[model samples]
Target: MNVLFLGKIQYALYRLVLAETPEAYLLQTHTLPSDLNFMPTLGNGHLGYTVFGDAIFMNGVYNGAGGNSKRARIPNWLNISAVVCDRFGCATDDDELSTTNDTLYEMDLRDGYFRYRKDYKKLGITLEQRSYPHKYFNRALVYEVVASRHATTARSNAPQFLKLSQHPGIASDAFEFVVLNNGSNAKGDYRVIRGRTQVLEFERFQPQPHEIYILFSQSLEEPLQIEWPTWQMEITHRIIICIDREQSVALKDLQDALELNFQDLHQKHIKRWHDFWDNDFSIRIAGNSLELWQIANAGIFYLASSLPSLTTNQKNEPFDGLSPTGLGRGNLEADYQGHSFWDTEIWMLPVVTQFGYDYAKEVLEYRSRKLEAAKYNAYAKGYKGARYPWESAYTGTEVTNPCCPEVAQQEIHISADISFALQKFFAQSADFDWTCDKAWPIAAEVAEFLVSRAACEELKQVCHFLNVMGPDEDHANVDDNVYTNAMAKIALEFAVWAGGMCGNASTELFEKWQQVSNRLLILRDVDLDYHPQHEGYKLNTEVKQADTILLGYPLRFDKSSTHLNDLKYYANATRESGPAMTWSMFAANYLRTSEDWRADEYFERGYKSYVRPEFKVWSETPIGYEGSANFLTGIGGFLQALIFGYGGLDFYRSGNQTTMENSGVLMPPNVEEVEINYIRYGDSKCRWIYKSHSSFMDCGYRKSGKKFEMLQGNKRTLLATNFNVTHRKGDPPIYINLMN
Candidate 1:
């Protein structure tokens, strides 16, 4: 029950206890009651739900209508079950209740809701249930039930019933159920819907030409009796399923979400979950590791309920975004068809561009609406610009997995990782006319497909990149793969520095991007001095992750002792079942070499083995079963090991000054202190904090005349408008050891 806000904490309410059968509650559950693979999910991001104990399931809307067949583009189902009856018929089911004795099972992550309870005691009855998924009626889904009896063990001619069932998926066949009596009732009580009232309606039909419409309504009114043996009843079910390929507009949006008003749509779904946890960007760490502050506040609410905003398909297009099992519903024989990868522009758009810069500009506007299907997949492979697709979906072509054709034809650094996430979203939203009308023409067609897919060897003038696949999918078609030649030399020097900041500079494409960023090959081994996760990768030291310590942290491109000799030679050559963002990129390259106790022992061994145990949720290997479970690239590499590793925070752009550096905070010898508090940077919100030897920061700019500077460890400070600085360890050093 913790759940606090300004005074921190933010989430809690677990409480479990179910073992009364189903194979002793499926051997004390850890998922597998017919697997929704480690269940417990609820999403507002284009509808999602899982909860199994007494059924909930549901997952539609992304590519909605039986999704245009590739075996109906996955994500189906919309179950929702409930039942409890009596009249000497004694019935009770919510997966046959039994938290051993007086049943209970919760999961409330503060108001996202889900509860269940039971207590019979020789029929003196008691039941309680709650559910949610109507964050502001986006096609509604609410449930509430309550029953109590006990007037000295009530039995005065018992009569009770509360049944609700809607199945809608597995490619439906047909269905409909209704009970609506309109006697001018709008909660004028009339014994709540008149005479034990019941008004349920269902509709289903599937075949890619999909449709679903459930609409159930209740609050007691139809033949639901209990002749006062000390009664107390309360019901509230406002189902509404909807889906659509137009079955009469999915039965008029399930009768306008069962005629609204469930306490004003549950107070506008609790003020849209309190404006989604009070306007995003939040983190609070004080120390004694409560499992690293509940895995960094449940990895920012499972990446904001698994990537919300942006939904359209069945022809209205717009998808190519959230995947890695986001819109949930998987398993019809290993499905992940809900595509988009290169792990969403390099590990979930840098932790969703720090709390949504308009959801990281709708994931670069879904890669500028799939840049003309990535320029016709580089003009049917003749190549020369826009080749983005190591598994896109809803039409950005290359839907991979045709039995992994070398990651769909040699993972050509996913078009330079979508031109380095559109040059780090125009260098963190400086937004020069939307990076010259949408990301510098897709970063000049991804530097013209990495200069026509590299290779130009005119006798060692160098520019190889050969047979690629670097973000370690375990050495496939390798050669010169130092994190794909340092992200194709930072996407050809950020397409000649974003084509000279949008004036569209191109002196012969800036000398073919300075001869492919100075002969791009990058392999280096000089007798294990380091850097060689490619080009015969030093005869296999193995590594299926952090390809060369990601060139000294998110391609800072090598520094000091060659970034600590390739971060201690690939952090012991990776693979401890690699993936979970490989020890969060070896805890952000061991906190960029300050090595804070080896970055707090690989960030507590990558958060106690890739999260998911008592459900802190992360999963993408490390014994949490095959991929996806709120794994937005291992929660954006554990929020880049706590805001760029122990809050050292970075953020570039030097010439027209934007800086922000920090390089002070480290605290990892069993963390005695740490605080990030907030991090939005760029349209600022910064914050920092640390302790041992002092530190402080605020950066500020929740919208004002934006200007910044603050360096730290080597003194800078500048801030132009909103500020709050403080340094300490003899002040005059606010960040300039630039990885010396």
Candidate 2:
């Protein structure tokens, strides 16, 4: 869904009112005329006023009162009024409580066209407007009230009831009133009447016989005194007000700021939105509609603007997309709280990463810094090592509140997913050092936790990990959560490899890791040639649909590749599964050694039909859409399916025992294209063969004292960028038969 924003004009009013620290409440009364023909609801073809505030300041935009609040409202003549109040509503006489601060802000915003002009006059403020087609609204007069506060003696010595300060510390405050309307129209006349006296009047200006005239009034400002400390008390209150309008401010010793005439700022906002959409490079799709794209683009833009930059303090930021000012208010307090849950990492990060890798790295670093906390949290629960918080906030503490007090606490192994995410980031960016350092330790800790959690039935040669929740929030705290167990196994294996690669790892660490791996379990049904999600999965007739897609995602077992033929069986069983289940099936179909047409069929159904229409790719789908619709996990899997599934990039252990070879069991060698760049770490040595549909081409390059071979098909040429040719170390040089 497009990020719904509270209407712009109303939001502007709220910001203007809350501009100062001295909190204020703004209220207005609309009198239904006895004639019932006058003062129609302001928004609908009549007049209405709006209040905008920021921190401690407030402003208002005026429209003739006529439109209905419920139905529809778009005024022909627009003006603005403002006030700075103490609470939400508190005004007085002597210092006149009935008066309203007003400004004549004239504008017409319709059909992407707007024109606003204001002039300051002694009698009142005059406004003029002309829209895009040169459609002129002529002129209007608004009698406005000017409120000003002169010097006060309250600062002399604890004096309370003197004239109040305007900005408290600053000089006096001033308010200007103006009358606005069409010079000749009478149907739109209005007045701010306190009892029997009219405080302000709006008069319309026009030239023709058939012209219209509208009238409204402005309130004058009165000086009032507020309680203030006579002298210094080693204290200060700093208020930073962000305004919708652009105005200049002068702060004495303390800081005071203002933004007035902000029409240009609005233009800048729209321009930024446009720039983002312009830069979005999507491969041309066959049947794509511009309207659909606009909706998707707007949603993406809204998501980015609402979410904060991925810096440390800014993680898990939320914006009240549905509120005015689009600020984090209400439940939108999810902003600034830094609750970096799976939503940020799994659902949102892939999009951010595609746009900016640095942002993605910041999120990765945020998670890394929290690793120690995860470990301690796990230990607190009596788990052997780290168990990531199901919901992590700024403190890195588990925010996963259990279903009830009786349960004490919910099992949290989602940290396994966190480790999985780290691995994926490294694989995508080729950041080996990060993987070797930060990721390895945490992965190792999680593996340790899993080892303690795993149980074995030695007679049956079965191992099983249990007591965790899967992505499907509908079910919780179950055994062998396929998602969790698969991730744990992968985390364990990778951690072991990482530790061993360090060479100087302690024997204690290695032995502990071995114990964890040996206890790791996989439940298999030899007759069916497939694995179950968990021990009780078969007994859970209601949950029978969970095994296939849920089991398919982890790709934990080596034999999953051999189980692709059983998909139709799984699909037939899960025919009634929901979209979340369906999306998982699509991913599994893509990952396994399945037929291209069958995989594509599932992919289309899941992506185009099952998931939200708003989710066009792996990037836009949030976790709410799928169980674990996460950062790059799904996207990475999607990419892997494209490359490894269709391209068949599998590397199997060779019979020679010293090397791995492309099995060529899936995709045939002579088909499309394979171009790769390799970066070697440490003393590892390997050879790559690039084969094309036509003929084989071969070459090599050197960089930073390291050599890499470049192999191309005979029909294709090696197009190198920023590289120099070189020979592979200790390899037999071979000649290429070029067409030339």
Candidate 3:
């Protein structure tokens, strides 16, 4: 037996970057956030609240004027979180504390659970609590934890007296705070705060029209005189925060919540989350960087949490809209003051549209609902039809901070961005009825506005959007911005088709749209072989972020020979201080090109420095830079890189092609195999895997109109919505599997 040793066993334990189990969809750490923005957050679409911090913001809820306007923090429902005392010197006991007994916090993105654990080692007791917002509900947050002394603690000889004071309820109001005296009750726990939640506006600090209902309770009666102080004690507590526009409605909803089993509600919450994770065309890499897997989910979780789950039959069906910072940041000057920007329509749309068309529809509807405001904006600006503001808040009016009036004045492309997104939505969903009813109207107005806005030579094909800012904010006013003009063309073209689908357009209108689409200046430099950012654009001229390269992406503009050159050139011009999203666009654009040389490098740069460690919360700028926290804009961009870039799924028709679909999968050489799920709004999901393999180009070339986007591959199988391939090196003429 001693002579028969066959192989060496190093016994080096392999650790997973993220757990493969459901538990892997969790954030657990003992590190405390030096910046509170790093804390985990929860939202029910309408309301955005944090688990451990004080920021609470409602969608479309703004209070103040000019730069002071903010997503005002309403009265804190958890006024005094919790307090526990013992025989020795008293130390405050808070489960929400970032660190306690080496286990500070655990956030399960799966079920939206935020867990907190506190230990009293000397006191021989432990406090564990978990909370989650009913992500599907309009405004429902549930917090629950049960604790009691163990029966095995009978060995204790001495008894101890413990007072747990939970001064729970709303506090800090712009109106009035009156403490109600509940004379006497056998139950040690009690409710203290009451009445309407008055959130004051910034200018006057006066109460707003919205009202919130706050309720708190405990599972056990308070003043427990323990027979033995050393007895293992446990207790259960629950808190439910319900908010509404009317006081009565909030109260009624709270009462209804109390009637149902909290556990059952929690289960429903978990199910809704699965609806997103299960079929939303995400990924599961067999052997690759778990970092992307983790990030994609985190970005989706944060983005989805801030969205109203339309699955529920809640009264407030659709939320206002999503902002750049999402539900994570508000009130603080750091937030976007709950304002919706192009971030919503473009940055956030791809993932939501793939995961839940219902959510995507609601996002478009948010704009349609505010069509009148857009019309007003156009009229005030001396234009026709509609002009969506750069930053829109409650009233859908331009709420672009007064500090930066240039954005509101010159970022006119936001309107076209909306139409572009709507077009993508229609193409992906193929929902004709929605297009006719909702999307058509929006496109019609936007097209009319653009026709009026653009300075086109009458009956000619030369037009320019003058004195407008491109995606690069550094250049405030530029002429014929290629990105803006191309997006406007897409919007105009969408209007043409949307009207045709609805049978509500004139032939002249169709001609006008085509004329503009054909004539809109897509500024190009034949000498440089690249599309200029705008007229008079100079090389390496310090762009703020993604600008001209966008034509190949969200705009779905036909790609030219200069597409790759444009991406490469901008890669140099873009400043290092650019936001997290810029790199993603560069990555996706490169991957789409026939010559995708720097695709891998750009893909890594997309998320490398922007994603924070311990928790994958993204920074508006690279980590350690001064910028907003939980930047969904960047998250959305990163997702686009994964879903469309690495995944190679197209949302818009390309280069005169009529269909709004394309799939060209690619992965880094280091990756062995990666599966991508294609989930368009109304289309059947398409899923396939890409493994490192080779002669893929020959197969794609043989196929008439199909384009294959892999570095190397031979065998091609028509599986689902993709050309599934299994390439073998130097082995066969070609292996093709056509699955019917």
Candidate 4:
């Protein structure tokens, strides 16, 4: 709500009043360079192709000078963007005209005007014609005139056979034109009327690359006409236009004017800002908890302020942040800017789902809406299911280039991310209808695609096609990435559930999914009591086997492996492999399994160790860390740890029955030094601890058969039970159970 109290980071990022308007503010963040910028040859050439998070990448234009892997040799200018809209705000169909193409459409308002040099009229001719940037902003640029023909009244008879002069030429050539003649060479000749010269100087100028100059002639017959039909937001029209003969115009004053008029864009912007403010306010977590709030607000700010609309109104666009390559650079470099990765579904989705469902809906809606593009892609690739591009844009074309040159290329993991988002949307929101209306069909289609993408490993078992990169891009193009396999199985399972519920499910589709699900393969060895990382992931006596927390922590596919044995092994593997975007998930997985005391050590090692010691920013690359809270989705697990780990509460539903169990933690759970008030749902009584570790659960349930027991972890605690105590053996831990 109140921008000032949002937090320091938000205040810093959200308070930069835009030059276009004061009410509008810009959000800012930065991306790191790849590999510490070790090579001098690195340049901006491929920056546009890197995909950063969910931001769409527009290809970076060639800057005349070539580039390399490290440095981005673009212009030196302050990267500026004005806030478009906020959390509650969106550019609707009414904001821009509907068309198959998404380019900005302009409709000129009546007050349209053109601009040109004032002194050109003094030389018995007007040199060139210029146009204002927009009706609101009086910035001007010159336009070249081509061929012109006019027929005047005989009374005028000024130029029946006009001669053209002083035509401006390009650096090396003169202007070319098509001369018009009468029907019969000598019949009636139409002459050029007021043949004027105009030229556009487009020489490469990096320093003043996009300098906008505005000028108004003091002796003008009519006001320069200009208008944009697409923009619905109000804007300040009054602007200072210079008419002096000076070749260059200073932007210092103009920048000030732009910032002042930023208020004109304020109405649309503030509406969006307030929308996010209205969401569930994050509570203070201990210490200067404002930082946590800052994390959330800053993320929202980045989404709101960074997307500069090339069109009048665009929705759900990604912010380029503070990268030097500008927005046109393809998926962000370092973060793989041009590529659409799984981070959106795993890390970012929950935050949006919890705070901005409308935004979250747009995210899902993007996938659903793009289904056709995905389908066409699959068709082009000779597959039955929609295959998403590893990195994509407006066209839904695949952009993933495999590292290995010899193998056939494929961008295979996107289907799983799509399914995961759909599942998250369903789980978090009361939108079952969405599943029936949109998600299921897409899910079924994706399942169909997965089916076509799989190979029969055995009877009732299918293995995903090999040589596909999994979540970790570092070890790319590997077969049966454990995470990828887990995702596929879950996707197929969800697809089956969705298809069975489809009232008019396509028979062919259903059979295809059934066939695929039947043959889906999982990397598990019953004889060795092990879960292989991949199909052929073997471990020598010297090479230790690693644990994959994804299967148990996130998917819950294997309930029997409640306490995973190989977590330490995987932790070591991740540490040795260096940092990765997926590493946070793995760390959170270890935190989920580790008992109370052990969690603090692993949390620090995984989360804090990698985070920047100064600003606490988490960088996608090891070169620099920018704080991103998308990985904070694991905070939900912290809550779970309190209830299930220490509070000893577990709730499960089957058929018509619901079960709840709990134990008092007495001592709160600590997540990165932020303490959680432990609470449990059982016996209708709330158990809590004040200061001491001793805990008691005052059983509130009066049912005769309900029972209570104390759960002791590394420490022993009292369970003050008022219900009949039931003792059971072979159970791992004590639990207070409530029965109807």
What Cα-based lDDT does every candidate model obtain?
A: 0.59, 0.35, 0.66, 0.37
Clash counts for the predictions, in order: 19, 107, 16, 53
Error of 1 at 93 (Å): 26
TM-score, one value per model:
0.35, 0.49, 0.83, 0.52
Per-residue lDDT for 519-616 in model 3, tens only? 88788899999988999989989899998888887665757778888887889889887898888888888877877768788777778888776667
Best by lDDT: 3
| lDDT of the structure predicted as candidate 2 | 0.35
Where in model 4 is the C-alpha error above 4 Å? Answer: 1-275, 278-283, 288-332, 401-411, 457-464, 474-479, 540-547, 580-583, 594-596, 613-616, 623-740
Q: Write the per-residue lDDT of candidate 2 for residues 541-597, one digit (tens) a residue.
A: 333333434444334344364356345455654534443324434544554543545
Candidate 1 lDDT tens digits, 149-224:
5456445534366555444344321222233333234753111110111111111212232233333343232333
lDDT of 4 at 34: 43
TM-score between candidate 4 and the true structure: 0.52
Top-down lDDT ranking? 3, 1, 4, 2
Instruction: Give the least accurate 10-residue stretch of model 4, judged by summed lDDT.
Output: 38-47
Residue 327's C-alpha lDDT in candidate 3? Answer: 65
lDDT (C-alpha) at residue 243 in model 2: 15
Per-prediction CA RMSD (Å):
22.0, 20.6, 8.6, 18.6
**Residue range with the least summed lDDT across 10 consecutive positions in model 3:** 6-15
On lDDT, the stronger of 3 and 4 is: 3
Ranking by TM-score: 3, 4, 2, 1
